[model samples]
Target: MNIIGGIFGIIFGYVLIRYRERIGGMLGDPAWAASIGGIYNVLIIVGIFIFLWSLTTMTGTSDFLFSPIINLFGGNTPPAPSDF
Candidate 1:
């Protein structure tokens, strides 16, 4: 759980730092970049669900433990990207 949260945080932070300009422009506030960072993590979780739903292979415990737990309760509430 901690590892997953850490990875999510790193990815979110990276997005905010890398695209601060364009994201800031779209949302009319520089802080929106930071906001969108959280959204990116949510999208990753949702995408993982969709991908897993389409497959039959057994997922490793590590993968399931991290992303699933984060999406279910570890991360932010009212998930960003407005898709939680």
Candidate 2:
């Protein structure tokens, strides 16, 4: 739904923006519409890809990101000094 909505909005907005000159005869002017639509489309695409990539990459391996450092130290984490 997100992708579909984004695409639909982008297409519609692009059409209105790109044809602003022609549409000027009717609507005020859609200059910003084109650039805005382009920007929106780009943002949506980037966001969707990033989200999908992240989902597929959730390796549940907590250590895959940085546990090796803890393991290298033998996993015996020193407790912080007690201020009490």
Candidate 3:
């Protein structure tokens, strides 16, 4: 399941980066067209992030990448049992 989701993310990210102009036009936003540089840069960054993240996840190494952050926040502790 993780692999499937990662594959989809990679494809979506590639499409986003590859056809950003078409996507902006499809949104029908004049502001986007006028100030495309900023938006384009943002899209590129997001797309690249998604692609790399998916790649890591697909390889089952995302935990290595995220474990430090997770530990900083207290790690992956399970919820406490309810008293009921």
Candidate 4:
């Protein structure tokens, strides 16, 4: 899925770069341009942060950072001992 997503991203980026001039002209209003750019930047930052955070969780650091949240949600308890 990651590979497929990366391929799609590359294709989409290539198309965007190819048609940037036409797209810019259509969105030429200063307010429109600013809002569009701002939203794009915010989403990119969030995506990068999520990817890096996932790496941390996969490496077992989630215990340090997420244990409280898990415990708060009642997810970290061990099973009760079985009676003989």
C-alpha RMSD by candidate, in order:
14.0, 12.1, 3.6, 7.8
What C-alpha lDDT, on a 0 to 100 scale, does residue 25 get in candidate 4?
Answer: 61
Error of 2 at 59 (Å): 21
Error of 1 at 64 (Å): 29
lDDT of 1 by residue, 54-83 (tens): 232233354555676677776635645855
Q: Which candidate is the best by lDDT?
A: 3
- What lDDT would candidate 1 get against the real structure? 0.51
Write model 2 residue lDDT over 1-84, tens digit each, in one string.
555654555565556545544555555434664665544444455455544434334534435644777779778587789999
Candidate closer to the true structure by lDDT (higher is better), 3 or 4 = 3
Worst 10 residues of 1 by lDDT: 50-59
RMSD of 4: 7.8
lDDT of 4 by residue, 27-80 (tens): 554654466574344345445655555555455585788788899999988989
Q: What is the lDDT of residue 70 in candidate 3?
A: 96
Can you list the residue pairs that collide in candidate 2?
none
True-structure lDDT of candidate 2: 0.53
TM-score of each: 0.34, 0.31, 0.71, 0.37
Question: Model 2 misses residue 70 by how many Å?
Answer: 40
> So what's the TM-score on candidate 1?
0.34
Which stretches of candidate 2 lie above 4 Å from their native place? 28-84
Please give the range of 10 consecutive residues that has the lowest summed lDDT in model 2: 53-62
